[model samples]
Target: MDLFKSFSTLAKAVPLACLAFGAQAETWKYAIEVSQGDIQDLYAQEFKKRIEAKTDGDVKVNIFYGGTLGTSADATELVADGALQFANISLGHLGSFVPEIQLFSIPFILSENNEVNKHLMTDSTTVYQGMEKGFAKTGLRLMSIYSEGEDAWAANRAVRTPEDLNNFKMRILVSPLQVEAFKDLGSSPTPLPFGEVYGALQLKMIDGVGQPISSVYQSNFFEVTDYLISARHQLFTSAIITGDDWFDGLPTERQQLIRDTMTEVTHYMMDEVPRLEQEFLAKILQEKPAMTYISLNEVQRDAFRARAEQTRQKFVQMVGSHGQQVLDGFLAERDRLEQQLN
Candidate 1:
């Protein structure tokens, strides 16, 4: 009586072949915009290998890296329309389609890798079920959420408190929650596509960006920015998504194989991405001795957390009843996990 078992029974009642019109082995395309060396791209490649091997070639996953399929927004559309089989979409970009996913954008909720890893490893938790239920409403099947790391602020200037962030034009993905959160932090957030970020920063179009350590390194943002602030304001989470109808059409065994492979890969990433974060941060500091690293004091950190709680309240109002249900469950689960960890 697990969620997957319930899905399997539902999948059996429908003819998946009716949607794709073939009984032959299926080949799925998983799209991501990062280069191969980036954390997300690496995980996509690993998911592909594990899935195809587990299914013994009965199911094949092909990865389209470097935005071959399109931007993250484009990837979400492709998955929903059933043209793309899978994608690793950021919660910010995903909020446009499913507002409930924006809960992950609530700053300081999962402030450390350990809290994130807790959610990543436990699939049967209330938060996990709530996330799956939320995604189902948007017609996307949620395979799993991978911990990308806590978001830190990278900019051309140092930031130690909310006052230091005044008037900074920060780059953010297309999420209103992000827009509101940064505005609360005293910055003007400019929503931009990830591909244009590098040039924008180089041209002084944006003064900063908030992203995980792996992204700051992999995207070469560290080279352009002069400061790295360990804000750890939000846990950067990404989803492995596919069209619900297409996934339901999949034979139950193939569905199980996909889910199992995702679980394996999630655990692997939980270990690997943190290690990469350390290595990347060290490498960045080693190469650019002039880059400044700022660690916020408790009072400064608390200011951001207070702003985040206010932002979360605004979001609860925005999504109304449905979002409230998920947010309540998520916060409760977060408290339980925090207690367990402490």
Candidate 2:
């Protein structure tokens, strides 16, 4: 009788122990491979803070920065597999799904803050739902979009005209849109990883690269590239994501808590990115003081813009039925948002 009583008591304690540990589970782990200086890192910090504040110790968020967990491509796969609870990665590198994200790298649709913002914030046929759909099928998700600053061309020499670009070799990501755009302008684009870019430029393999000014500053590309064109070619962004299975398994309240906190985190991220963008652009001038910053004349700007138009048409065809509608829907939604902005 005594042994039976002891066994029953132990069995009852097992469930209690499990509940106790569950109550004290630390914050979720968030991974961003970018440096502490990057916007995604800032967002991760804000998310950690907000989730902790709201959950009152029930949840804590742990973070890793500077590719500590994995490269961006690997991060996406890991997050989908539920090996990672959360991550922020560039949609560009996740070519296995969300192919429409490539449209951002296109020369026109995402070339400016207003246009990109319109795409993200505006409501219409343009919520990137297809991206959400495709990611769902693969066990990843779309949590939020982190702001990436406007892009520019940094070169060894002053690139004043289309003719100047044609004579130069540039590093471009191997996306179809980028290849076609560079080819259209007469420059041959070589696809290389961001880490490899500095070496390529040093070895005279590439005469220039198109990138955000802040990225140029962070990587110290200003040393090799003597000039910058505030080309603002595209507004870049990263996707915050989590394992779909993990997200689906969470209690409804916990899901809401995370969603709400992440929104606050996004605001902090939005403010921080633009602030850093301006700071770096200004620093580039103040620090080096000798590097030329190219401001395109209105006529030159229009010429580049004109060349980008056909590329949009190309995207519709390239993305096929799903992406074609996304293209059409985005354009109409973009027009509406621009109207609201005006």
Question: What lDDT does each candidate get?
Answer: 0.80, 0.73
Model 1 per-residue lDDT tens digits across residues 1-342: 699998997787667656556556678988876778888888888987887777677777888886787778788888988999989888787888777777777777663547445563447354456666667777887778777776887898988888888989999888988888888877889998887898988888999988888889888898999999987776678888899989999889878877888888888887787788888889889988999988788888988777777887877887777767766777676667667776
- Runs in model 1 with CA error above 4 Å? 1-25, 111-117, 120-128, 131-134
Clash counts per candidate, in order, are: 1, 3
- Stretches of candidate 2 off by over 4 Å are 1-23, 111-125
TM-score, candidate 1, is 0.87
Candidate 2 lDDT by residue in tens digits, 273-336: 7778888888888888898999888787667777777777777776777777887777676666
TM-score of candidate 2 relative to the true fold: 0.86
